[model samples]
Each structure stands twice: as structure tokens, then as C-alpha cells.
Target: MQMHKNRPKNEKHSRTVMIRILTCIRPHTALVALSLLLSVITVVLTLYIPILTGHGVDQIIGKENVDFKELSAVIITILACIAVTSVCQWFMNHINNKITYRVVKDLRICAFNRLQVLPLSYVDSHSSGDLISRVITDIDQFSDGLLLGFTQLFTGVITIVGTILFMLSINPYITLVVVVLSPLSFLIANFISKRTFAMFKKQSEARGELTGFTNEMLGGIKVVQAFGHQDEAQEQFEEINRRLSGYSMRATFFSSITNPATRFMYSVIYAGVAIAGCFAVVRGMLTVGQLSSFLSYTSQYTKPFNDITGVITEFQNSLASAARVFELIDQPSIAEDKAGAVRLQNPEGHVTMEHVSFSYVPEVPLIENLNLEAGCGQRIAIVGPTGCGKTTLINLLMRFYDVNSGIITVDGQNITDITRHSLRAAYGMVLQETWLKAASIRDNIAYGRPNASEDDIIRAAKEAHAHSFIMRMPDGYDTVIAEGGSNLSQGQKQLLCIARVMLCLPPMLILDEATSSIDTMTEIRIQKAFEKMMEGRTSFVVAHRLSTIKSADMILVMDKGHIIEQGVHEELLKKGGFYARLYNSQFSAV
Candidate 1:
């Protein structure tokens, strides 16, 4: 289950998310300040047009002949205001976009930087597709909504205030009438907005699930086709895709209705104000020009209701994206390093585990009270059936995971007492599953030892039996591999990984089925190289092929998270225990 499962579905959470967004915006203070100042100028200039038009109307009222000079001045002033308003509006949009995009870039960088420091367990538990969505898709959606909401949000506020003040100066009674009916637009918008927030949240979740499914399918496309499971995979993808479409439809439908509904109510308010103004005009209580200006003010005041309601509609989607992003940022990570931690330098690789116990979850331990030790420069080989905790032992030794009880130590000092960087740096590891990024072969080989010389990188590759195929390529060492090195064979990728570890040449080595992909003939040929690399180094080997581990200094047979047998190869066979049975079962088949 995801930690995001019990999301805070309350107003406080939404407010907090918005506060975070504001924090991002606040960093670019000059841009936002300028945008807001332009917005105010634009709105004030727009409101001035109506006031001038009202004065022109009063001048023409009850006149046998028009005052040409006054009329010309009124028209000139209105035109000048429109031109200035256009310029201010243009600058306001430019500044808003600059602030919005800069804020979005900083937010994405923060999310990516957070992932770099997060513990490995959190990465293991979460879906890759969902994290990608939060970093890429969700941030884009959230920023877009923020841009739309804020741009109109500021202008809408200023228009409302300016219109209200001008209307009050003209006639407070009519202004009050407009004010009372304003809440009707808000009421309808509130009713619709309440239903939309949850719908958008669900839609965002379904989108991430669909994205996850697509990534999984593509990454394993070869297996899916080889096993003839195409139809099954297609069915599963369609199910998730259809679910995403349904949630999107519901969210959009609710958002779409907000603008039209608010406009409908505004139109009703407009009609009522016009009728009331006519009576005032006929009774000589208000001038014709004032009535005309009052009608215009009524329209302007009511228009903001529609703009604000539209913001309410779009805010739902932004809120949904924000919640997902925060969920990832809020996941509990493994405890940080203790203050004043020690660093291990030139470790002798004297590893020991005493009463160590651990589990992926509590109450059902995977390794319980297991005790083990390996002297400096001893080669330890661990053999077991699937799920017998062979790999779990190595994980504990490296402190990839901390043991629930008991301690693991190196060179007589507790592993936890050392800085993680210094602790992990002591061991050179090569796993069964190879990892290669989109970089030159030489760069990948020298990843750990970045300052390694060209001659040393080639020497390591030659020892690992990877030099011939690499040289056959047109670009040789400079050839860039695609992500995952899809063009390379399984054995080739594994050999490259081995070459990487050999180049680093750390104090200790861990080979987890390291060369399982190589053929028996190839393995026999590379045995000399393996012997050379493991010389005088504490090496732990986890191999399914019993032949590869026959010469280990110490052989451990594990079953159900316990050490079932321990001895040299000949002695273990003499006992005819779990180790003997496992070894004989493999050779007998051959």
C-alpha cells in the first residue's frame, strides 16, 4: 500500500499546499510585484472609461445642440484610457508567465533533489510510473492551473473593488442591490465546486496508474510476447485506460458547468438593475447619464463573479496535482545519519553478524537471530534454495537495510557508527541484474572510479572477458549505449558490470550470481581472472551453480533464514547434511 493512501482530505491540507505554492512564487518577488502593479493600473484605467462616458451622456441630455468641444474631449479621454489599459494588460501577462514558469522549474528541481537523498526502501515500495508522473506530468498540470487562476484572480479582484467604489459614488442604493444578488453567483459556483475537487483527485490517481501500467508493459514487452500473454496484458491496460477516461469525464463536466451557471445568474442581476434604474430615472431621482453609468457598473461588478467562479473551477485540478506531489514529498524515509558519525578508512574487511534479525514487515522476520563471521581476506560462499535468505544476508551485511535486533560490524566497529558513504565505498558489488545508463562504455566502466586512467579501464575490461566484443563495435570504447543497453546480450551486459567492479577494486567484494549469464565454457576460461580479483580480499559469493563456489574458504548452507550447515566443501559432503544434498542434487543431474 502507498503512504499516500490516507491523504489528508480536509481544508487544512489544501490550504497548506497552497501556502507551499505561494512560497515558490515568493522567491521571484520582483516579477510578481510588477505583474500585480500592472494589473491594478489596467483595471483602474478600464473603470475610468465608464465614468467618462457617463459624463458625456449627462452633457448631451436635454440639449438642443450638442457641445462639440466637451464631446470631443470625452471621446479623446476614453480612447487614451483604452490604449493605456491595453499596454498595461500586455506587460501584466508577460510578467505573470515569467513568474509562473520560473516557479515551476524550481519546484521540479526540488522534487528531483529529494529523490536523490531518499532511502532505498521508499524507492522499492513505490511505483516508478507514479513518481515519474509527479515529477513530470503532475507538476505541469499544477503550474498551468496556477497560471490560469492567478492571472484572472488578480484582475478579477481589482475590477470588483473599482466597480463597487464607482457605483457607490453614483448611487449606494443601487450598489447595495447589486451586492445582495452577487452571492447567488457564488452559491451556484460553490455547489458545483464542492463536487469537482474529489473528482479531479481521483482522475489524477487513475492517470498515474495508467502511466505505471504502460511503463511496466513496455519494459517487459519481450517477455510478454515470448510467453504469448499479449491478450492478457492488453486487457489489463485497457481496464486502467478506461478508468482514467471515466474520471476525467466527470471532473471536466463539473468544471465546464461553472462558467455558464455563473453567467446565467449574472444576466438575471443585470436585468433587475436595469429595471430599477429606469424607475429612478423616470422619477427624476437620478439623471439619465447616472442611470446609464449605473447599468454599466452593474455589468462590470457582476462580471467578476463569473471570473472568480471560473477560478474556483480550475483550482480543483491544481489542488489535486498539489496533493499528489506533497504525498511523495511527505513519505517517511529511513532515519538520517547520526551526528558525529565515524568514517571507515582502509577497512580490513573483518565482517561479523551477531544475533541479527530483520524483516520487510514486522511480526514475520526473514532472518532471525542468525550469527556469522568471516575473518579478514576469507572467501565466503552462501548457497540456498529460493527465498531461503541468501540474498537477505548480504543486504544486512552491507546495511542496505538495518537489522531489527543485534548488530553487524566491520573491523570491530558497528556498521551504523560509520557514515553510509564511507561504509558502502568499502565494498565493490556486482549483481545478477546489470544496470547501464545512456553513456559511453568507458564512462559506465569508470562510473565508481571516475578518476581512473584510460589504461586501467581497458585492463579491467580485458580481465572480465568484455574487451573483445567492445572492441568489435565501430566506436570502440566511445560507443554510446541506449538506456538499459537493449542492444547488448545478457552475458555481455553482465561482463561489463563485472569490469566496472574490477576497476574500482575496493577492500571487499560481493558477487550475487554475478556471472550466472555466462556459459560454462566461458566461466571456466574466466576462472583465472576471478581468482586474481578475489586474492587477499574478503569476498562473498552467492551462486546457484555449485561448481563456482566449490573452493570457498567457508561454505554456509542456509534454510528458512537459519544457517543449516557450515564447513569446507569435502567436510560438508562427509556430513551428508543440507549442504551435501544440495551439492549432490546439482552434480547428479549433470
Candidate 2:
């Protein structure tokens, strides 16, 4: 498995980002085209008003008196134009919002589905909070940005093009002034966009960090309060929040300057065109009606500059968000079951690991040249000190990770050749740490075998000695558990987890310090339950408590990834080797 110590940087090209975003919109092409067409129609109606007003002033108004008829006609025409423009604008927004949200929805779903199939190694190394932020927070930002960008960019382009044509028809000199000042707006937008993009990227990252820290702290809130870390946690969160606020302010500060800077240029050119128009009228080079029309057209032409710049300024933030979502989607998934892979059906539960070698990191080998065999219904107990590759071996057996070399086989068939679904289904596991959902006791127990009958679920709970305590809850099996099963004691949570595995009824079982959280009294009941459950199933019991595994058919004593001794407890103690020493030391400490 490839592991990255550092998070990947958002380095997607702007063109790549735009293309991906466009591709998302491509599915709703017909709706998008209609929205753009409405934008054009809206612009046309708007431009028509200026034309009718210009004509009324030039031909119908007398110098000494106002022409109410022509003025009324122009006013009526402008009002009609506004009514149609508003309707078109509303419908266009409706379409754009639909298209934008649909695209973001699809993006979020794809990213989430990808997470389900991603390698456990990657999931393990990454922060859940940051991943959640990317899935929810970043995608929402992308949608907002896209919606705004689409509305502005579409109308901005059409408005600029239409206004320029009208202004040129009235007077080219005034149009020239607008054209010349236009680049300054873009230049300012361009400069500010580059700076804001970087600032906002950092801001998004800071938000993710803050989110990750909060999630981590909340998940372990009990420990935090147990040690009185409330103030420390608050202070740390404030530091991150403060840093995020600074980035946010800086990004806002840079982006906020864009509109005002462009509008300042617009103001300069607006006055310049009006002043130059006055001179033109006095020189008889342009008429009063024409100059008036030209001034109106100049404002229209320059208004797009404001919008386009504003869109450009805000678009950078969306681009930053898009880059984050796409980066997550682009990670490689774990290899699927091989072609022609066989399903692991009912078996006698013979398992073997031949010449197995593995390392979490390439430079550091944790297990080397390991070989093991267990026949059907054999009970193998694996005992070792911490970090001795005990759990790592179990991880391989479950195919959570593949070995660096050699073969893991069941019933003489290589596990790699078995469909992972069926291969994993053959084994039931109860781990050291119990994980329960915020669900009812029944649902939590049924999680292992969703189709299990109610009687079976209850039976499994009874076998794990959880049914009596469960009945005392307000709703018995229907009683809802809190997150991480916090509503139940640690032993109660473990019992539910064990009940879950018991319901699976697989040919093989894994008890990886499964009773670690249970008190001595409950542990005795659970161990008895394990005996009945493992009657005809091969079981690998990983435990530190030597007493628990004293009756295991074969005890494999391990140190530094190598099994140094194998026998029943008495035989191993009689050898007086490393296993004997460990047993003595563990007992002496107790």
C-alpha cells in the first residue's frame, strides 16, 4: 500500500478545473443553453430601450418644448423592456440554480462513494474531519461560486457585447474611451485574482484543520474533561480560529478591493465620456440626443466590467474548493477482486500463511518470513508484546491489507484468488476497541448480519450475556444507543460488539483482545460464550491475558514479529523460554 505522510497540495490547473466543472454542467446542456439564450434575450430587450429613447430625443423632441408623446412612448417602451427583462432574469436564475446544484450534488455523491472503496491505509492516515469538510463544506462552496459565476459571466459577456455595438452606432470616439479603460478593470481583476486565490486556498485549508481538530477533540471529549483540558482545548481552537479569521479577512480584503477598483475606473471614464460628449455637442460634431444616448451606452458598456471583475474575484474561491473535491476523487481505489476469482464457499476452515512478509513502510519490515498453519476447528492463540505484529497478522488475514510477499490461503486456495466479499464473509471478528453506531440495540446487533431474524439477533445477544442488561433499558432491544455507544458502559459496548460478531456465525472467528474492556465477572461469561461459538469453527484469539487462552489448542508466543514458541500453556511454561519469561513477568506485575 502507498502511504503519504503529507496531505496532497491543491495544484490543479485553472483550465483543468474549468474543464471538469464544465463537464459536470455538460449533462444538463439543454437547460444551460436555454439559460444563456434567455440572458441574450434579456440583453436584447435592454438594448432596445436605449435605441427607442435615442430615437425619441433625436426626432420627436423640440428645443423649446418637451415632447410628452414621444417621452411617454419611450417611457412605456422602457417599462415594457424592464418587465420582460425581469421575467427572463427570474427564469434564467431558476435554471442556473437547478443546474449548479445538480452538478454539486453529483460531485458530492461521487466523492462519497469513492471514500467507501478507498484503501483502509489511506483512510487510516487521513483525518476524518478534513475528509468530511471536503465532502460537505468544499462542495457547497463550489456550488455557490459556480451559481454566481454563471449568472454574472453569462450576462456580463452579453451585456458588454451588446452595449459596445450600441455605443459604436451612436459615436465611436466615446466607445474608444470605454474600450481603452476596460483593460484596466481586467488588469486589476487579474492582479487581485492571483493574490486572492492563494489567500482563499490557505483559508480553506485552515478551516479544514480547525474542523479536524474540533472533531478529534469532540470524539474524545470525555478524556479532555477527565484531565481538565477544557481551557487548553478552547485555547487551541481559538488559536486556529483566529488564524482562520486572519486568512478570511485577508482574502476578503483582497477580493473586496476588486469591485471598487474597477468601479473607480468606471467613474473616471463615465465623467470623461460625458465631458468629451459635451465638447462634441458644442462643436456640432455630435448631437445632444446622440451625446445623451452615448453617455447612457457608456454606462451600460462599463457596468459589465464591474460584474465580470466581480465574478472573476469570487470565482477564484470556488476554484479553490473545486480543486479540493477533485483531488479527493482522484485518489486510487484498492484493487478489486481479480478476474475469475472464486467465491469462498462453505469450508472446513483450514488456514495457512506461507513465507509472509509485510511492512507498513517500505524501509521498515515488521514481519518477515512468517509461516503458519491451522487445521479445521483448531483454536490458535496469538500472544505477544505490543508492536510485535500480532494485529498486523490478523489485518492480513482479513485482507484489510495485502502482504508484501507470499500467500495467504484458505482450504488450499490463495486468498488473493477469492472474491474479497466471500473471503471476508467467512470470518467474524470482535476487535479490542468496540465500535457501535448511534442506533438501537437491535440494529447494532443486526449490523453484522442485516437479514438475521429477530430471534437470532436476540439469541446472539443472550449468548454474549448482553440480553439481560439490554432488557433493563427503557426500550430493551429498541433502546437507542448514543454515538460510540457512550450511553452504555465500556463492557456493555463490548458485549454488543461481541453479540454482533456472534450473529455472523462464520466458519472462522477472530477475538482480538475482544474482552479487554469487560470486567472479570463479565469476561468469564463472554469467554464461555466464545467457547460455544468456536466449537466447530477455526478461531484466532489474540490476547495479552495468558489465563484467557490457557485452554487454546495451540498457543503461539511471539516476539519481534517471530513466533518463538508454540504449545499448550503448560508445555510452553515448562520450556522456560521467552514465552515463559513473558508469562512470569505479566503475572508478577498483576
- The TM-score values for the models, in the order shown, are 0.93, 0.93
Each prediction's Cα lDDT score?
Answer: 0.87, 0.89
Residue 115 of model 2, lDDT score = 99
lDDT of 1 by residue, 1-590 (tens): 33234344545567778787887788888888788899989988888888899889878846586777898999999999999999999889888888888888888888888887777788888789988998888999898888887689889988999898988898888788888888888788877876787788888899888888888889999999999999999899889988888989988898899888888888988998898889888988789888888888888887777888888778888888978887777776667777887999999999999999888879777888899999999999999999999988888888788889999999999998988889989999999889998999999999999899999999999999989999997799999988999978889888899999989989899999987999887788666778899999999999898889889999998988999899899999999988888888988866
Worst 10 residues of 2 by lDDT: 1-10
Candidate 2 segments whose C-alpha is farther than 4 A from its true place: 1-12, 55-66, 230-239, 285-287
